[model samples]
Target: MQQLTVKEINTLVNGEVVGEYTGTITGLERIDKAGVGELTFIGNLKFSKKWDTSEASVAIVYEGIKIDPGAGKAFIKVKNPDLAMAQVLEVYLPDSPHFETDIHPTAVIDESARVGKGCRIGANTYVGKGVILGEGVTLYPNVSVFDHTSIGDHTTVWSGTVIRERSEIGKHCIFHANVSIGADGFGYRPSEQGLTKIPHIGHVVIGNHVEIGANSCVDRGKFSATVLGDGCKIDNLVQIGHNSVLGRFCIMAGNSGLAGSVTLGDGVVIGGSASIKDHTTIHSGATVGAGSGVMNDVGPGKTVVGYPACDSRDMLKQWVALRKLGKS
Candidate 1:
């Protein structure tokens, strides 16, 4: 068991300690569930109010909060308790899966592929012709990299991910299980023979530090690449349609989707299950609320809510007015 003193934990987060605690912390847990020898955190007033009832011997609290570290308890105060907790949790993190060998015997690499040094290819993985994998790349079991795809150094692709032909992945990116990159877009037109599907000849370009969750899909474009900029984070079951362009640090929560040709500027956040209309542009720092159906462009730093989304303030006022009418 790894043990850390209250003082040691405080040093890790650069926090101000409230009590002279000499107890050792053995683990971290939720505030309400924490016990003796365990540490917890409070980021808001709701959690801070639980301190008296919580069993934790130590805690990390937001700075400037009115928290009392009763008799035996200690509090480490920081600017952001959530971030500090994350840094502390790293000490308790377990090891991830790794291959015993650099290249597993069951894995297949095409003769024309260029795999850099220190790459770890897990069992049953396939690297197709002209594939380029930079150093320290890890392709977990059952991963499929198609022809001409390039993955940069230190990128880790989890099991069952499929990178179709011509895809480009950048350094230090993580792709969770079952992710589909460079898939055909849903493009069809009415024709004499009913419906004709448009050919998707382009690919996907993901920038450095991007992290895509499990089962997400990034569709290939009709003529150009579908791009995800550096530090973009996509949640599980999200969908990025063909030719969609996302700028740096964009975040799409679970089940959120962008229709074809959508453009999102830096720091845009799409809430869970929200859908952006085709050809729509969301400027930098805008946020779309959960379950919203966006049909028009959103300005920078604006927040939209409701079904057929409008400005958050306007939507709240509308809700209040509706409630008043119901009572009238």
Candidate 2:
């Protein structure tokens, strides 16, 4: 454990120290929750009172924040404390954990497959026939890559992620534990006698810098590619249905589910547990708040929230009206 002084902390973060850098800060936390020997942060001016009462040894504050210097806490001022905190954690939680580049003794690699240079295939991991994995790829324990699947350079698939046959995933992507990509889409049709399954005949294409969170599922298309654009990020337990198109830098929060054929434009943000109905097109830069249910197409750069999600203004008005009615 590296015990960093206030001076060392400022050097590491390039932040201005309002008090003596002699006090030692052992670690970092949040302003509302940090204790002794730890450094925490206050994101905005509203939390100034909270900063005064926080028990942390040092507080990382954004510029233009004014608080009592004698509040028994040191101040570390930065242009962007959140970004600096991220860098601090990176230095603390370095990814130097041991991973042997050699194929594990128990790893199963197909004879016809091309496993690239400087790769690590963990125990019980299966690399199928005709799979072409690029350089610096890593498959954690129990990963299953099916036949003919192509994974690009510098990709990492965490434990228990299943990549189905023929799915093409781009470079620098992450599939967290228990993620299922290229699985058969949920396709069913009603018949006179009973329900019949629609055949899923297509693959999934995930672009670079995309991340699929733990327990999330991205289903394959019926006859074409179900795609996620570059730099898109999916949160844990998300369900992306078949043939859905997610644009660049889009974000889906935890437990959100998108139905089949949904098209999200660039930088679309959906909150936790939000459900977007099938085939809905959320335009570019739209933001959907947590637990929203979208049944229509959302216009670009608009913020939507609530069930059958409406525009943010309308939703707030409706909530206010509902509260008034409840009082009456």
Candidate 3:
């Protein structure tokens, strides 16, 4: 990242400096681990202990937070510091251009397939029979699009990602490297003999603008569609199991695992390494904190954190009391 001055940050994000300060910040990071020349945030007062140790030149903080005067860190006060920081950071990204549209010679496109004009199929990609790919779809090297699958316009599927048969992917959806959509779920039936595999006949249906991260798996349903609603942002290594339905604009962080038949309402967010049980429902705007083990349904707009996932407020209170108990 290029160095940005304090004045440049204020201009980019429309923020004001709370204290008299001027310096060049090289990058953005969290307060607990920011290095020299990096600008970080102090959203939670709990992280105050790490402020003194932070090598950051400046910290973006909200009004009314008291830091140690000895720390000597310049502060940027805003109505919402985090949002301002994010806005300033957005300008540093590279622009994507539209130029080429052509399939590679090595790509094996089935004669029975129906592909839209101007689609680009990369090397070693296999578009199976009866597959319907909309216009401007770009498949990276080695992407396997199975039979009867339908992908909407302008979707980009990265290398090694496999779309199983009969899946329905929406427009502008990006499946990053090694993403596996509409794969068979782990379903078995107990019989008098041995375990019998239950065939998954249902598909995975994704809505528009949904972006799936690298190496993630969204399994095919047993009978009905496993749906990912519009604009759901899933992170790397996340797993959405069979028959699950995620609502619009849901955000799931890395390594979050949702069991089969689970349902998430709109704007739900599951933190990193969180595990949600099968058949449980998460209501709209709910948040599950990092490492949470959710066994029961979550209420709308509530924040849950901890093992067996209790309310975030109750968990924080218990954690504070427990620490004091240990000290006593």
* Top TM-score hit: 1
Ranking by TM-score: 1, 2, 3
What TM-scores do the predictions have? 0.97, 0.92, 0.76
Residue pairs whose backbone atoms clash in candidate 1: none
- What lDDT score goes with residue 176 in model 2? 92
lDDT of 3 by residue, 1-328 (tens): 5678777777776666655445687778787678877888776678666788888877777666776424345777677877876776686554543424488888999999998987889889999999999998989889999999999999999999999999999999999999999999889899978899999989999999999999999999999999999999999999999999999999999999999999999999999999999999999999999999999999999999999899999999999999999999
Q: Which model, 2 or 3, shows the larger TM-score?
A: 2
Instruction: Locate the minimum summed-lDDT window of 10 residues in model 1.
Output: 91-100
- Report the C-alpha displacement of residue 104, candidate 2, in angstroms: 0.6
lDDT of 2 by residue, 250-301 (tens): 9999999999999999999999999999999999999999999999999999
TM-score of structure candidate 3: 0.76
Residue-pair clashes per candidate, as listed? 0, 0, 0
Show model 2 residue runs off by greater than 4 Å.
1-5, 23-25, 32-36, 45-47, 69-73, 94-97
Preferred candidate (TM-score higher): 1 or 3: 1
Candidate ordering by lDDT (highest first): 1, 2, 3
